[model samples]
Target: MSPTATTPPVLTSVQIPCCVCGTMILPNAANQCPTCLAQEFNLTERLQRGPAGQKHIVIHQCRNCRRFARTPTRYEFAEHESPELLSICLKHIPALNQHDLQLVDASWIWTEPHCMRLKVRLTVRTELLSVVVQQRVMVELHVQFQMCPECNRDFTNRTWHALVQVRQVRNDSKKGLAALEMALAKNKTIRQHVLKVDTKKNGFDFYFLSNTHAQTFTNFLQRVAAMRIQRTTKMVSADNHSNTANMKTTFMAQMVPLCRDDLVLIHRKAAGSKLAGSLAIVTKVSSTIQFVGASPKRTHVSDSMMELSADQYYKTEKHYQMLQAGHRLVRFVVLDVELCDEQAPSGQLYEGPHSGVEKYALADVTVARESDFGVNDEMFACVTHLGHWIAAGDVVLGYDLVNSVGTDDWEMQEQLHGGFTLPDVVLVKKAPRNKETAAVGVDEQEGQKRMTKKRERRKRYKEGRKQKELEETAGRMGFFDDINEEQVDEEGEDVDADFEAELANDPELAAELLNLERDLAQLDDGDVVAEGEDNQLVEEDNQDS
Candidate 1:
């Protein structure tokens, strides 16, 4: 029957003759065409991903013994049209993105009655261009939370999830990377799913996207260059850093905080699951805690919500921010700090009061700062913050202090947690000896000398401030006082401000004035030294004569 003119053309299956067998067969095989069953070319549509945003490409394969073996086709003694031709060749293929193709389908063609032919097409779903630009890289953050010192036994119930914008995505080998980057500058959080990542690829360099179009990738590159620094530095004693011990498995991801609570359910292999112990809520978050306290020592555990929600007594305090869509999580709990005393000099460490009652102090307050790392004197400059100077060898309360590193960095971290910076007195030890040393006497005389020098430095600081003020006034008034006319002062003037103003205008005389000032200062210093030398020499000559 004749079809209507408006009807769409249907794609019918193609059939071919078996070149060698000279037999008729179905047009389609499992993944190949029947005629080419003996010799078929297979093009596979694999779901394997490359770098997430790089439009996925479908691999083409020729059907033969080797290529056909890979497919689940029933055709066994298949002969190929071209045995010598590479089955999986990148050529003889069309360039298409992941979404351009359809699902795995087979067809066939032939030449002589002796041979058959097979063709396979792989398919892919369409993708939204705007959505891909929305998110390119996922940003996951984890923080340990805590409550105010006044709050007793408090804990963060859950981690605060933020879809921080990772500015790397807008690039993705595109022509409009700059335009895309400029658009995303105002927005930070991105939808987690929007940023597709290929875990197989070690790194992703895509900037996150937001509602206000995507930002230019160039801007994100600039931001990454500025603020990133080593978040944590692990330093061992001078002797241990190089040769420190190694273990079987080093880094690991532990369970989230909720695992600590007894409210969690534990399942058995045979019987049904039951409600177990509670996690230790060492830290606080108004109502919910990161973990429930189950034991004396704090450990971590995490199971899927589907598995644990079966026994549902625990509270879920979802804040307004939690409603936003995101798959990333950041979990942590700030702990109640305590001072502990132990047996060794480096003993009595400040362990956490995690579940019930435990103690932990700045490593300094309890034991010593392990000095085996590369903490040398030249690398760190020691300056007294509040008129206190700590010596190298004095074991103040018992902890070891590094050369001039007055206190531990962790000690000051407490200040960020609503605590204040540590005082000079917090230094537990004089720090002259290692964990093996006995109480050695400190030189009382040296301590007194240190106090004397502090007074001198204070006096010097006062003089320096006064000098700076006078020089500022001299420059602003456009007049020079002899006291403020020291050669050093002139050289120290803001060159950028005066250089062009003076030199640009009086380019000729500026050089002379500078030279004359420098010469005068040199002569004055020389004359003073010569006069002293002459006096000493004259006295010596006279005494000899």
Candidate 2:
């Protein structure tokens, strides 16, 4: 027996059954078969669900600026695929074993205001066989909206942290309020912080959501209004957790009673001080009150030494003294203007609150008010404040002092030389009055209507004639309305010359002119024969004579 072929028994490879499912599998396969492993690991069915049964997210969103509430001072605008949305969506996700389950991919499918959808791919591993399989799960997210604190406070009820009282002690509260409103319009930040504005008789009361905003507003007034600010706080609540006291703050901004162009009388005692007493006109008031002389050539300027308080300065009833007041304004025609030949006076001459007016060269002006109406009521005016604002032929408003007394010798001299007292009138503004229109009546209206109709007819006729003339001229110049009307060849006719060139170069035009000449000649022949017969009769009668 050929030494019995020592070949080993035929070795055969056989498929092995999976440990879990007992199904045939490759020898190198994992412990479980593919179908069994796939059946064991199902992410779609085992995906973590929300504690509320549905993937829902609750967030506070501002309806006004469209922001989500996260912190007391911070807000975010949520979008369709924002990380904030993803974080909020998965906040309640169930935990998974990292060794067996892993997230492969996740994405938002569709997002709307009320609802959203998400797709997640999870790789799940079978614990027994270590077989890896992938499963995709769809998640539905429901969004519920709640108004943010800001929106709630803005829309329904308001809780303010600060109150601001802006008071202008001036009698003209409307003007002050108008200026404040204008300031609000120019600054957007101030407008945003202003929660409410209530108009009071003296000024405005403002409510602010934050104390910082109120402080900012008060600081702004310090720059614009020469105001005094006072701050006070009241405890609103105590927090045991923070061991802090919550307080509501109030800001009061008291603006000076005086304004630009206001005339104030400083006490004689305070004159040498900042008040610059006598009759001081307010040139500018901001942080400090600026004063200048009331003279025509107001050349001197000074600042208040001390803060002007309401009690320190007395209010004057001479509202008409300031040109900006408008009520005391009187229209004057410049009759004459003459430069003073004398040397400019020194500040010592004017004495109290001279405002350096003595250094300015003065001019004597002769004027008559329009109200006098050529009644020979002439007044002398020394324009110190607005000297250059007037000239000959200028009908301007002049400050009148007919009802007052002179303060200085310069004013007395003006009264003596100008035939009246100091500032009998000073030019302020130019006002021109037009001829008054007559009242319309039924008969006059009818006549006016007829006249208007006639005028319109004439105008139409004139316009039509001009248009026709233009069209005729265009036609005569061989300028046709349309190029299609041009009958000439590609080489157009030479229009530089007139009749001679046409007859010589254009045979058709020459033929037409020849026919016209022949017709005229035939008609002239009969007329000539009749004239010759009449001439022969006349000659025979002349020979008999």
lDDT of 2 by residue, 1-545 (tens): 56665766998778788898788877644667766666665555455545455444344456577675565456667675677756544543453423556666566665454542443333444344545455556655444356667677867658888999888765421333434544553455656677766555467677888888898888776766656678899999999998999789988877666654344444334433443323445555556666654443333322222344332333422221222332233456777655443444322223235454332234466777666766776666564433333456656554555633343445324322232223454443334333121111113344456446545654656555444433433332223223223433322121112223212322333454466446545655777899899999999999999
Deviating ranges (above 4 Å) for candidate 2: 1-68, 71-75, 80-84, 87-106, 109-144, 186-189, 268-275, 284-289, 296-326, 338-369, 373-378, 381-383, 404-545
Give me the candidate number with maximum TM-score: 2
User: After superposition, which runs of candidate 1 have C-alpha atoms over 4 Å from their true positions?
Assistant: 1-85, 88-545
TM-score of each: 0.15, 0.50
What's the distance in Å from true for residue 67, model 2? 5.5
lDDT of 1 at 304: 10
lDDT tens string, model 1, 1-545?
A: 99667967999765555445645434433323232342232222222232343333232232322232222222122344343221321122332233444433222223352222233233323223211111111111111122322121123332111112222121111112212222232223322212321111111222122312123332343232211111112332345658763222111111122311112212122132221221122121212222222122221122211132211212221110111000011111111222122332332332245433222222211122233224532222111110111223323322112322323545223322232222221221122233333223223354356446545654656466445644433332222224444545443343223222322222223454455457556766897899999999999999999
Which 10 consecutive residues of model 1 have the lowest summed lDDT?
Answer: 320-329
lDDT (CA) per prediction:
0.27, 0.51
What is the TM-score (0 to 1) of candidate 2? 0.50
